[model samples]
Target: MENGSRISGDRRPQVGVAVFLLKSSSILLGRRLSSVGYGTFALPGGRLEFGESFEECARREVKEETGMDVVRVEILTVVNMVALDGPDPTHFVTIIARAEMADSGQSPANMEPDKCAGWAWYEWAQLPQPLFGPLEDLLKGGFNPFAASRLM
Candidate 1:
């Protein structure tokens, strides 16, 4: 936990981006590849690089994690998970982005095979059970940015 300090005790803060790609009215879900939450179903996203803008990081992470290029990006919501794991724990900034999938037809690329086991597309009403944190938030209307931010 460096800038804006989120961690309380000895726990380190992690930064990650979560993208909600809309295709044919369905959102894409990628299986968690590595162990922080391996085998779990989640959105296409990852940690931010040093000095990177949140928007840029979100776009790059989504492409790398899901192999699908994003044609457009709109900030959906921002979740501060620094205090989610009790008073002293791991922290994370989950930036939810609404993205349009490109027509790249690229397979998941540069992925950590050991981390993610699978990937698929699902309708909002048909998403698999036990949705990951970010996805859960999205479905619960947590990512309603324009309204959430009072922009609309």
Candidate 2:
């Protein structure tokens, strides 16, 4: 309910879109500054707006968060996370997408300093420590963005 959504009676889970922006042998990640996952590394993405297609959400979020355009946007996987132990008792349906930079030479900028510390390209095999919950779940579920991208 951090986004102002009613938490008292709303049992519906929120939908989030996470993009794995692959470039050469690395993927884009940013250190989150949000309350839910502060200091955790996560992909460039946000809540899936109403009436928005998955691809649209992917492209829009990447642009909004990183100030970089993405291409070949495609859904790679989905994750269902239910954290009932916390006071908020939140649930999230995360859609994971894969994409490439519109311009390989274009570097990412910290578009939302309040939400993320900074952005960096990290190799898949050696991601940063303390990954976002959804991202950790994705990895545990064996969803490899690099392998998925090659198949697509």
List TM-scores for all candidates, in order.
0.74, 0.89
* Cα-lDDT of candidate 2: 0.88
Clashing pairs for predicted structure model 2, backbone only? none
The residue-by-residue lDDT of candidate 2 on 76-147, one tens digit each, is 778899876556677889888888789989999999999999999999889999999989988988888878
Clashing pairs in 1: 33-115, 33-116, 34-115
lDDT of each: 0.66, 0.88
List residue ranges in candidate 1 displaced over 4 A: 1-12, 82-88, 104-110, 141-152
lDDT of 1 by residue, 1-152 (tens): 37765544566667887777665656677777554554668877888889987778877887666666776677766777644454444568887777666664654553656657667777866778777765666667645332334111
Each candidate's clash count: 3, 0
